[model samples]
Target: MNNAIGNSMYVVIAGAGHVGAHIAEALLEQGHSVAVIESDMKRFENIEAMDVLAIHGNAASPKNLADAGINSANMLVAVTGSDETNIIACVIGKSKGCKTIARLRSPDYLREGVGTGNLDVFGMDLVVSPDVVTANHISRSLLLPSLVESGELSEGQSLIIELRLSEGNPTLRRMLGSIQLPPGAIICSVSRNGQLLLPERVGPLELGDRIILVLDSRMLVANVETAFGVTKGGGTAVGGRLETGIDKIVIVGATKTGIQVAKKLENEKAMIVMDTNTERCQHARDVLEKAIVIHGDATDSALFIDEGLGDASVLVATTKNTDFNMLSCLLAKKRGVTRTMAIVDEPELKLLFEQIGVDMAVSPRMMTVDFILQNILGKQISSTQTTLHGSGITVLEVLVKDTLWMVGKEFGNIKFPRGAFVGSVIRGGKAIKPTRFDTIMPGDRIIMMAPQDSLHKVEKLFSYHSGTWRFR
Candidate 1:
């Protein structure tokens, strides 16, 4: 979660696209009040279905925001796909004493400094770029790929992975009693096409069953591959766009994915190409950088044991050979390294990594498509996956205006949405997990969580703003 988020703020979100809707859902899950202003009829109808106070109107107009209960709101987030639209909504919302944040894609907005010439000029608080985020995800995965992607759904001491079913599945039709899950790990849920997966002690698995499981980070990938049906050595053969580095990253691969990761991360990154091909590495170095290049079979585990990876905090592996990255990560994990990451291109490998344990894995093509589709008119995103990969959640810091509507209301009485988790409360800067008997008074900022579906209802539950929707 971004540091800017807290609990307890009346929020007005403009646009319900991938980022916008994702933010709205996050805010909703926190139990904070949110009113979404959408200009598109279809988008409005869709958001309305989520049970939020969705209004169909022009977000570019101050009246539209006011209608969504903005004047009395504590914050407003503009996530319209168009940078200009987001800027306009945030500018107006900020002027009304509502803290505002906008989403922009221009790197120029994030220049080394902050001021009138940048995002600050528009009264925006945050600037997010799907491309940059996607690049980072890809880079992190390329570094390790062994552990699947990170942060799917993290509960304290636990993580979830979305694994696809593959051929020769050893655990097929076997109950949890039969399968040997790595120590310190347990199967959490088995996600099928569209269902809420619950732990079934006697559940039977079938072919093509996509399992979502969790395991200890210390488990070995090789063991996981053996338990599941994977290529003899987890072959490489990655395929993606190719480019050079903008940051000084030393990737050890010459395959398509290796090239793609390089291309996406290109710009100001002085990348050091490492491979065993003296001629090819030299050629790659010639086109990318003329720095010291290492040429040797990276599959040799002794090399990593010999030369310590540089001070670089990030490592990427897109080598055509999966075993190379996998074994490399196992060695890295043994060194007591905390932030080791990996990228497994195989869709089926998603769950295998979880059964073992890897930091993060990302599907370039799926993420790209999801990111692009998330940019729509008014609303930011639509699906549940996008919500997690997108903003997913928000923290609201709100001052209770000491009104009768909230003064005596108990949290349980509010019955916050299913997904919302109330984290804490702030009384004069000291934070505390609000007690059940906690009575809200004036000048109190309570943090909350609500699903996107509950955003509208949350707004009405605590909204003192005049623009707040009054339902029967």
Candidate 2:
């Protein structure tokens, strides 16, 4: 998990589009040697300009992959726009004894029992689906309007929320340890002026600083809002009071991303999907029986008025066209929609959308990069560890195997390394707040937080296996 020289890996990436290029840049920043293969000459030039080895050739071609050093690569990432090309390149990479990962766009590839083998058996160790990732993120953001970002751990029993400190907040100018945190809540990391700080030695919170908090339940979010003085009129923070629970949802576009979002929200709200393409509208209508699909351009202001956009609790712009998505969201905001979110393809456009009055702007390429990085680097550790970007910490979700070192021992008796702590423990799918008196048992998944350098020691502690079950 640590980016030590001994842990540096050789990674080959196929494709030079936004998703592929972003992944390559991230891997290089983490001290990994990276090579990218792209067919487009312009994209090849862009990758080459980044000071990495760039091969201008078809990624699925054996000669192109060989030129990228596939034989010596530790892993191959296929992320071309075409699903077939990605799958073909991964298959080739797998044959060369390299671990392969594919960026699959079609849900059919992920469908259970689809006649094709599982990802691993199909020559891919993992599959990253940006559409699904974007849809899930939108769903969570819709549910928690106050949270800047939300991620769940411990089988969705524990939650991580990111919120920004603004003026008039109660926690400002106070020592980290002095803040009255709710039960089972902790401030894990802080971001100040684009720099990360651990709570141990960090100074008093400052306005505009982003803080990440881990809690045992979503119920604690209200406490956080009250402590930080965040309200519906707060400045630059997504933390706000929703007038009502999500009841009406309006989705623009019937692209794959739009369709996926509609599918996720259709059951929870009264859904209306709008698209310019008649065929796509028909397809969405057929698939989403509960949703009302309209054949019209989402960017048209007339259409928004006709649909009564003001009544929508949540308006999502999922169209692939960035301009259309941004314009539609602006119109929705003008119409007094409670919340607006747009799926921006370009990272730079996010800031532009925010300045133009959009409530939230998400980048699919950025989200996909995070998903691939976590999965690829996580699989390297025999005991997986996910490196929380920008936070100098690594999180490991490990099962309490039947090892004498851990099983049947009280939490306080075990000697945990410095900078390592058990965040939460899941037993039988129920979250348990770890206490000194609690005894470890087999089949328990313990979520641990550790500094990067100490990850090896943390993993070594749970590496062994004694029998399957153990009683305390």
Candidate 3:
């Protein structure tokens, strides 16, 4: 049976933890029918308050899957703490003819699916690892220190970045059309005083205006920074040069997240990992070749000096302990570390950490939720949609089809919905900065940004033809 809400799917989530609850809430907001199964009584009770079929039982049990309405579920997401339980739930859901996604933490299980291009491993249509996802986020931030937020588009060939205009920015007083941006970069939208302004409507940029930019991934981060007039010296700059110039990198905690971060960066920089547990340090040493592992209290101020954290270019705290991670980053910053990042357990603390001097604060749960939501909705909507942090704007990457109404039409002729801005068009494997005169062609991948409310209108323009909806 189809949901009364248009284009809505029935989704069964196995787990009531942070990731599962967030997923349920997001789906509900999108008008999808949802159900959640949780073994923990407290967690189950908490999720039951939502408008979902809350089944309190082990998600791995077949009876529990049936109780959660797996028979009619369009999707089943298993995000419990136990990897095996998640996998089993996915298998059960898959048998019931539902698309399944599992969140696995073990590297062994992740390697079997993620990056292999075969997400169907263990009967799961998609597999996501929060620790690995969070590690990748931290690695990208460390590698490209200037980006406030970033995501890949056009299959990783293009990148979308958000940067807040700061004082002394060269482009601060320039009209949106007059700024000298990099060759492949296009300013998608500007967030000014809580309003999202399209490029055509934006005036001269002011300090504190957050600008979203879509560009070729190969463009230098330094150039982007220079275009915005971000200086190199003071801690005021949000990002650093693309070349990184990072000589030494220190990671606190030898946990899975920390180890993954070190693993991604060890080959490029002088890597050092510290943890309070000697056993964990030994484990890190055994697995990581280029990293130097040390057992020490990260919160201890003496350890920072003793390990020469003062000379380090970037310090990342990845422990499970939020207090420890915050303390470690703060201490490292005090000792003169150029950049400090922390893995935040609570999403609310991300801003607090940044305000208190942490250069970046990443939440694994949020990252996992984003990944899952993108994958699930991307299939149903025929487009990739991601929301820019704190901005009511969402970036959508849509494939131009021959049946689209705008096909062969100049962008200037198309009456796009208000608050919608087409950023770039990818055709013939190259990203093009589209002008009003550019012609929309079939097979072209159009990247655009629009307000949440305007998304449906934007989609209708592209997906409707001859008074009928033809979604591709």
TM-scores for every predicted model: 0.44, 0.69, 0.79
The 10-residue segment of model 3 with minimum total lDDT is 463-472
Candidate 2 clash pair list: none
lDDT of 1 by residue, 1-472 (tens): 1213233557788887655676676556535667898888888887887747788887878778888887788667676767788788888877777666665655456553221122668786555554444555565433322333332212112233334443445566777467665553444344443343445533777654554444334233344444544333332222332112113454666443444456545553544446766676766655553334567654465665465553333445556455666655555555433233345555345445434544344443344333322221111112212222122332222345544365667766667656554544545543444667777765555544344566455545555332222110
Count backbone clashes in candidate 1: 63
Count of backbone collisions within predicted model 2:
0
How well does model 3 score by local distance difference test? 0.76
Single out the weakest 10-residue window by summed lDDT for candidate 1: 375-384
lDDT of 3 by residue, 1-472 (tens): 3322235678999999999999898777666789999999999999989999999999999998998899888788999999899989988888888878888888777672242123576898777888877777777766655566677777677777778765555677788777677777777777786677777888888887888887776464567767776544212433333323367889889988888888888898899999889899989999999999888876777876787778888888989999989988887777778678888899778767876888678888777887787676662233332355455566777777666667899988988898787877777766677889989898787887787789777766654451222111
lDDT of predicted model 1: 0.50
Backbone clash tally for model 3? Answer: 2
Give the clashing pairs for model 3.
145-239, 146-239
Superior candidate under TM-score, 1 versus 2: 2
Q: What Cα-based lDDT does every candidate model obtain?
A: 0.50, 0.72, 0.76
Off by over 4 Å in 1: 1-9, 16-69, 95-97, 111-122, 134-150, 155-158, 169-175, 191-206, 216-472
